[model samples]
Target: MYRLLIADDEQLEREAIKFIIEESFPGSFTICEAANGLEVVEIALAFKPDLLFLDIKMPGINGLQAAAQINRVLPECRIIIVTAFHYFNYAKEALSLGVVDYITKPAPPEAVVETVKRLIVELESASFKERLAAEREQQLQQITGYFEDDLLVLIAYGEIEAKEIEDYFAILNLQAQTFFAAVATILYPNTPGASILEIEKRVLNKNVVGWVKEYMQKVGRQAYIRSIGAEVFILLLAEENLDEYQARLTGMRLFTELKEALWKEQQIALNIGIGGLCNETGQIGQAFSQAKYALRYEAAPDSIISYGDIERDQQQVFYPYHREKRLYQSILQGDIHASQQLLEDLLTWLREHTSCLEAFQQKVYVGAPRQLTLQIIDCAGSKQMVGPAVDAFAAQNPNIKIDYIIGTSPELPSKIKAQQMAGNVETNVVLTGYDAMGSGLVQQIWERIMPEQKKSFPNLEDNYLPAAKAAFDLFDGYGIVFAWCPGGPMFTYNPDRVKNVPRTTDELLAWCKANPGKFMYPRP
Candidate 1:
């Protein structure tokens, strides 16, 4: 639910705004109010409300001061000015402080409600389908932060407090009899300079969005919608019946509408993964995870892949793990051209090899070993700073996970005397989800702290890494051995254990000796 904080000296005004917001958004928000500026600051910080409504002519610490103080503390909290007169100068100053909009006193509740809705939309826009043009390590850091803060944390996952969470179950226990949830994953292209916010707003406006919204509009029902992973997902619970046929029909219509809107209206291709229904919210995560897994088996001959198909296919699977491993070996041997050509053949083999989408989604089950492949193509002799160009694009991307990935060059103009490495693949520069313009964090680090040292070995290119990314397209988030590592093995087994990282090779070897063949080091 959208959280709002109102700071009005007039108690009636606060109530009026509250009622206006309630009527406009209906059940989409939870609001908190304060009679004074100080109280407003307190509530806003504590609740972490998305929108703040303030009256300019307050008794103590007027609206402007409160806003400045609050803005200093919470840049994300957008302020709306409610003033008695046309304070042009005041509005200008408020805008400077990131006040969303200014309105005349006795503002219509509708107008107040509209402003809050837009801000929520804006927040969602910045995060839709962006990319981070940073190095691999930096991207990982960004991914972790997003998971901890924006993604998992907000949903009340493991130890986080969510009033919405309490209200979620309470409303159902007291009012509804049954619950159900279905998840959908969207796959969109990742590029630099693409505005995730702008694209998302357009996509959300597509009729497909309305189709889903209307499905949940019927009273005595609750539907929760949020963008997870790469797509928009919804949790639906029917109070009385299990219209399985109707639900499937609704999904089909939505899929059709979404496909049409995306292609004709948005000018993009979106692959959707739909899941079988679940009865409980706890089970819904597994359902969503399953759906996400289902998405990995992309490019199915048919659309609308479901969990049931996943079940039937598992019965007679072929090309087991042993065979998949051989394919990965070929890639590590620098047979990239061969792998690219075999893409279609490989997927076809997988389809013929597996029985259902479930087996396809879950690459390995039980004690089966995971398999992966790496393919690297030359950028076709592009100009210098191509990576930074990619970084520049990442800066503007909407759905990017990391904001501050270094993206300039890996060559330092000058080297410090103490520095042992220069003009090498710079060290991992980092960025986080907190940055608004975080594209350059990785590139800068790569050029400065260079990951490569000046080696006396004949094959120098073998040690220099041009780029590295944690490929979601790969198996279970494993590190793909770079193309330059042309050897028999395509993977350098993503160390299963990370509890201890030895600083010295001797220590690592002794640690390995203590454990006996438990570790593998990079070979040049």
Candidate 2:
């Protein structure tokens, strides 16, 4: 229901308008009446009416003057001028004041009803649009969160490309050029040879990321936080040129507050390493390295160390951060020989620095896949196949990281297309069936393998079965066949309702023709 206010100097005129409205709309409106301009303005302020009818001539303050005052406060209120004269000047002034319509003294009931109906339609439409906009905003925020997580993963692995960064910047509306990386490590129980998974469970159960985010908000800083195993990577963004002093100050404050908060909430201690300021977009990896380097000196729990505090000879210190990253990537890609060589080199260097290899064993994370990440969206209902395929793949390629989500086939094409149009496409791979494949084909969003790249998998099609090969041919290089299920379309009906089920295409057609509303099918 909406509020309606009728204002006039004459009591008879107000009654007539009210009777007409009540007769037409019935219980649609909560109607109010005002005898003069002052009374109307006061009632408008209190009632916040959706519609108003104002007489042009009133005692002292006129209707136009009252409307101007009301318009300032309740701009959304629809006002109609009720006047004794049909002067063009009054009509012009009413329009200037945002009056929807003007009805002369003793308005026809039809004219009054018509004007009210039109305004009601407009108000309803505007309200619907507002609700729709709010819903879209909520969905956009969720997508932004996903992009943020993806960006942090990319930054942590140091594999972020310029285009990928640009896309994220557009999605996040990041106007900052300067950034610094911070690594917060959980000071878990000093159990001999503790696994990363075990350590993560202990800290993650306490929700350290949530605490860190809360502290960040309290301090009014912009940063992306990602929890990887036992460590949390924070990429702090700055709009202006951040000097080393300012960066260190920010890190100290953030880490100090975070450290205190964690201990207070869950008795979990955090040791943070703050890297130096980096202005370039591509040098975030360097910041991460510096943070990791600083973290090595964290001798005790609740320790906060900055790269600037560490005094080391840059030329003498042997830190193969990039080589170690490459080794991890190699292991993820199932390159045994390259990873073996890299591992030997790292061990040989470790042997020279330390007397016993036993001490270094505790520092290294065994059986942990922390380097590369992939996000997979599946719409084919192939979880039983893809889950084991990914596990088997991970078993051989131990360093590869995968995040999977199941989606509906009908929504995948449009969702992905919308993401692309918004300049933030998050799906790395889409595992979908033929119906969605047809939709994707029309959308033209899929990335096709070029002829040159086909050399890497020379005999790809020859290994497939006949039916699978036919499906692959239909894709036209957009997708590949990983598995096949032998099944035909089946009908679903109540046993008591339909004793004889449709056995063939003709039977289904006949059933559908006979029972139009009862027989329904999903999109092809």
TM-score top scorer: 2
Worst 10 residues of 2 by lDDT: 84-93
Q: CA lDDT of 414 in candidate 2? A: 70
User: Compared with the true structure, what per-residue lDDT tens digits does model 2 show for residues 412-456?
Assistant: 777887565444567888888876787677567787753435886
Candidate 2 segments whose C-alpha is farther than 4 A from its true place:
1-126, 188-206, 264-266, 297-299, 314-468, 476-524
Clashes of 2: 0
lDDT of candidate 1? 0.50
The global C-alpha lDDT for each of the candidates, from Candidate 1 onward, is 0.50, 0.75
lDDT of 1 at 448: 24
Off by over 4 Å in 1: 1-164, 168-178, 185-207, 215-222, 226-230, 241-272, 312-524
Show pairs that collide, candidate 2.
none
